[model samples]
Target: MHFVYMLECSDGTLYTGYTTDLDNRIKKHNEGKAAKYTKFRTPVKLKYQEKFTSKSDAIKREITIKKMSRQEKLMLINKG
Candidate 1:
């Protein structure tokens, strides 16, 4: 399964991304190896996620989420 996920970094910032393995991806983020944004903001927490059947779909959703404002992202996470 593919996933579009949001993470809340230690600095209280948000990050959105697409992945196939949510657990491992978050592990990489916390380990400072996943994304440059999250690398510096280690110890991120999974704030939200949406599952998809295709990589394309997940990527699209990830882009959409990335475009959202901080308040909007927080709303989405709160909904989750």
Candidate 2:
């Protein structure tokens, strides 16, 4: 399975990305190795996730989520 996920950073910022291994991805973020943005913003927490059978679908969802305003993203997370 592929996943489109959002993370709440320690600084209260949000990040969205696609991954096939949610737990491992989050662990890499916490370890400052997953993303340059999340690297400096260590210790992020998983806020939301959506699963997809195909990687293309997950990537598309990730892009869509990344374009959302913070408030909109928060609403989505709340709904999830």
Candidate 3:
């Protein structure tokens, strides 16, 4: 399975991405080995996650989430 995830950074900002290994991906972000955005915003927490059977679906969902406003993202997290 793949995943589309939202992370709340230490600075209260959000980052969205897709990964096959959710736990390891979050670990990499905290360890400063993931995306550049999360690297600077260390100590992120997983706020939301959605499972997908295919990588393409996860990627598409990630893109959709990335395009959303902060408020929208917050709503999505709340719903999750």
Candidate 4:
């Protein structure tokens, strides 16, 4: 299954992304292999995630979430 995931960084920051392997993806983030934005934001925790049947769907959800304001993202995170 694909996943749409949100991470809370050690610096009180938030990041939204998607991957098929949640564990590996988090590992990559920790190891600075995920994205440049997250590279310096080490020790990120997966605060939220949703499984999807398709990668496209997962990516679409990620895009939608990324477009949201931080407050709205927090609300969504709280709701999840």
- lDDT: which candidate is best? 3
Poorly placed runs, candidate 3 (over 4 Å): none
What TM-scores do the predictions have? 0.96, 0.97, 0.97, 0.95
Which 10 successive residues of model 1 have the least lDDT summed? 57-66
- Model 2: residues with Cα > 4 Å off, grouped in runs: none
Which residue pairs in candidate 4 collide?
A: none
Task: Tell me the lDDT of candidate 3.
Answer: 0.96
**What tens digits encode model 2's per-residue C-alpha lDDT throughout 1-80?**
99999999999999999999999999999999999999998789999999999988888889999999999999999999
Ranking by lDDT: 3, 2, 4, 1
Error of 1 at 20 (Å): 0.4
Global CA lDDT computed for model 2: 0.94
In model 2, what lDDT does residue 31 have?
A: 96
For each candidate, how many residue pairs have backbone atoms clashing (under 3 Å)?
0, 0, 0, 0
lDDT of each: 0.92, 0.94, 0.96, 0.93
RMSD of model 4, in Å? Answer: 0.8
The collision pairs in model 3 are none
lDDT of 1 by residue, 1-80 (tens): 99999999999998898889999999999999999998889889998999999999888888888889999999999889
lDDT of 2 at 19: 91
**Candidate 1 off by > 4 Å:** none
